[model samples]
Target: MRNINEGENESKRSPQSIVREVIQGGQSVMSADARADARFVESESVIAENILSILCVPLIIKERIAGAIYVDHRQARHLFSQKDLNFLEAFADQAAIAIENARLYEELEEARTRLSLENESLRREVLVEKHLDSVVGQSEAVAKIQFSIRKAASGNSTVLLRGESGSGKGLVARIIHNVSPRRNGPFIKFNCAALPETLAESELFGHEKGAFTGADRRKLGRFELANNGTIFLDEIGKVTLAIQAKLLRVVEDKEFERVGGTQTIKTDVKIIAATNLDIERAIDQGTFREDLYYRLNIIPLVMPPLRDRKDDIPLLAEHFIRKICRDLGIETKHLEPGVLDLFVRYNWPGNIRELEATLHRAIVMSNGDTITRNDFYGLFGDIVPASPDAGPVPMPGSLLNPVIGKMDITSDIYDEVMSSVDRQLIERALESSGGRIREAARRLGLAR
Candidate 1:
């Protein structure tokens, strides 16, 4: 129970000489009466701290002595016996095991951290690859869009993408972000049409706690989150004038206050906006701000409708087939010859999205190894194929045309319109075929 007040000075006072010897030799050393021993009696530690009885034992780790433990009695002679030395050796062995276990645990933790970082890097790489691959075309129209994307990526100018819904406008935006200098920063997207006017403001500019009724906590807005990066505003035409004014500030000055907060937050973000609406028409109608349009239209990029790039239909269809099949955990399916020809002939008013949906339906409805032209019947409902007599092909129209008004029509409207047309055509064919569906299908150039 003797305490060593000068243990801190032992390393500096030449006690390391004896301790190092014991550690190197992997053995114990004892001086039952140090004053009676000439070896350490003259040492500064032994003389200054008063003569002592000492015991030292080596601390071995993995068959090598890393260090040693030394115990001494300040006032007693022969206080430590052979039994005490044996007990200290057993404690040293336990201490070595504890140290080794701690070292191993730290190494394991370091390895785990490295693995986690590697996995995250790999995941981001895969996402970028998947996004790039999904672009899926080599047509002139596609090549032109790719060229514009590359040009846009070279700068941080505000880009306004004008395209029909489902024409992969968002994908183009992401390509710009991934290739730009701000690629390492966050790419935040918010659909202006997804939230109500009240909530849209809160979402775009964030809100302070108690900003309004049911506003329980403060929130960070998309602009704030996308600082030093890119923020994609989908359906930007849907925002109200109030929100437009606030958004214009961000586009022009890169600063805005939260919904109810007085603090002005500055952001360094690139704006990439997409809208199916015609900015010209909207500006004329006073629904959209002219100044805002000018600021966002710095680089206007139009995404071509799928119908214009009919040559890419086969490539896109096959890509979607493989991707959707893999996602559904089903065997890969092929398209029958002439099916792709029919796809090319049909003016996919819904653009790329409609084509993908059509293919998804064909794959889901058909159990065969190949999707034939007949599979489109359950989806497109007797829409006539490539025939000289069926009817003239539906031309791709603009969203500003009052008759078309909106370019992005839903699947339900598409189905309803096609069904009505199909019903009239079927009635005429039935009259010509004595009310036989088989014969009607034949007259309409549809698959039976």
Candidate 2:
């Protein structure tokens, strides 16, 4: 509230003086005649403004003085009595309550909004972890990959995924993005090898309308769409040198301009690039940028090929079986005893993708609830050895005759012969031990 007249005496005559006194003293201040009172006789404002009566009280709430309230009348002396002071004090108490309630309400609203955002972030994180569980492996190599993924997801560094083509680099990239701090943001993927050189720049950096021939409208690029999120660049080694230069700028500066636009647009995105190419070889050949390679190699994660982690074959096969069955709307199928052994023996050149495809094919061709080695007859070719004859050999030396006769002298001849011998020995032990694996292993002098 402003004073009615502006003057040197205005500050002193204003009710603020009384309010301050009341608040500081934590009590009411009532002056029936302020100008005549000893407290104001020496005050220039009290006399010049003809301040006559005043009533002020502290606004206390919850044992704390929130503020003060004051009322005054200039034309009347002895106008404010103890009764009037009591009335103003009561009103002040009610005002303090209203202020505290409003404050509490605002605080509650703020807490609600904060919790809502936190809950949403947690929800996205949960979804991301669930998606990452699909990595599906229990081998040491797989465990290392998973650990690297967790470590990589905790930061904003650029990641370079090195692996064979079908070794699940793309899946690992998605898992990294999903579990990272930027999980809630968009996850945009671009296959660097999918586009031609002429369109690679426009696809990554966008272009304004009429920037080039056949340009009918403005289009946002992968980087722009991936702002404040993650952008996955698959087959990163396939992009041309010219496009690599643009990618380097965005990695180093976090800024870029559309193909035809002069305005520099900023973006906050986490980049994850995957490739099967030997990056060091490419760099040496001048096919890839060295600086960009260093920038992207901040967090390098190598995906293990399926053959290297053959122990996980059974798990992966079962996982894929259940998935394929569900997708095909059929009953889940189980593998025959020898099928797993066959899978372990063959070298899956196409890695996990090939394994999945092989399983899908086998499942589709299967006529019963179980998939046998015959189901994959032509798939593995000569790798699938023929079952031994039903009759027992007259002597142990006779077993070597058939095995030695069928074997070819090659670099892997030792492993091939041992694998066949091991299979035959285990089969004979199991048959003698009533199909008990532990008894069979014990009879074969092998530890369980």
Candidate 3:
């Protein structure tokens, strides 16, 4: 570098010719003058120059040249010394390691992000497969339900599934029918809620020609169509008292006479009834018969509510959001941690159905490419508000009461009483046990 600078500064040859000579060497070091003409751009070590006495060295580790260092000397009558060249080489070595370290750190960060995204995608795919195949969650309560479904599927037991709406009884019934020996046979579904009371009997049992004003020709009922298969009775609780007795006769003897026809038809179809209503209450109120309840409740499966399986909500939410986005013809968006927070805290009165609907609405309503808290604002207000039965609910009132109604602060109430009891019990327990939380927990029957 010193010899090159000495020749160039004296104009022994043009600066352009010196720059070309430097580029001819497949090395890392170069020097240039103040003319700003091309000095170097590394060959095996490409670099730039025009500031003479500028030392450029390649920072290489293994086979990678991480970076280069360019040191400029602007002083007059200055020329590079052998000692300065040696020092510059050492600086280049140190610079190479530092550059390598920084590059390694960036690569590690990029790898971490890539792994996280891959893992998230794999998790999402598993969830979608489960939801699409209808393989539901594995809560202990669900095991009991499955056991009942097995019994109902194997024999001629008429099942009555009791749970809140959206508890997946319909899905459970379908699973039972699909897994049973009758899967190859026809399986039909009927929603009693969507069926009118006057036409429910006709819907259940086909009417003959001219049986009624609309019966212009013969028609097959759900039972006939689903012959030798399974008949899924959804929302069976909505059936009237008359329909209940008729259903009981079919369950007991498998005999039914079509409307305005004397001939009796026998059906080999299995009956799997589902209801979100309390059949016991319906029976007591004369809307359902006790004998029919006994027959159907023989293979009873009681599905648990959403609050009981809180852990499953996060997985289910993501699964449902993906499915909804696909159905809506939109790109899938992930839920931020805040969205999970909102979902976990809000009580799901409508259960899985409610969560699905909320996510579908949010995906459509979101403005940005990513979903955030702003996307869900005001949407969850209904689920998070104070319960109405929590005394009047403080609504905008008429002449009788004001908008901000006074709260009853009675100590006997649930919130205050529980809080007071909790504090006093904790204090007494802690004192007796000398602040040993484990011992205190033992005394109070609490799990540590």
Best by TM-score: 2
Q: What is the C-alpha lDDT of each candidate?
A: 0.81, 0.81, 0.68
TM-scores vs. true structure, each candidate: 0.58, 0.59, 0.55
lDDT at residue 27 of model 3 (Cα atoms): 52
Candidate 1 lDDT, 197-260, residue by residue in tens: 9989987888887999987656677787778888899999999999999999999999999999
Residues 1-448, candidate 3: write the lDDT tens digits.
2234544544432234333443444255544443342534332222233344555555556556544444555443235556666787788777777767866775675455435543543453442331213645566665666676667778767777888988777677777776788876666777887977768888788777789898765656777667788888888888888888878888888888877778889989889989998778987888878888888777788878877877778777777777887777788888754567667778788887777778777788886555666677676666653465677435343632342145465656667656776888787777556456798899889997
lDDT of 2: 0.81
Candidate 2 residues 1-448, lDDT tens each?
2225444454444645566777788988778888778876676756766778877788898989978876767777788777787878788888988989977875675455435544654554442234557789888998898889999899889999999989998778878877898988877777899989879888788777789998765666778777888888999999999999999999999889988889898999999999999999999999999999999999999888888999999999999899889879999999866667778988899999899899999999988898876787587676734445555446655757866787677999888879987898888786566456898899889996
Clashes of 2: 1
User: Each candidate's root-mean-square deviation in Å?
Assistant: 16.5, 15.4, 32.3
TM-score-best of 2 and 3: 2
C-alpha RMSD between model 2 and the true structure: 15.4
Name model 3 segments beyond 4 Å from true: 1-135, 382-448
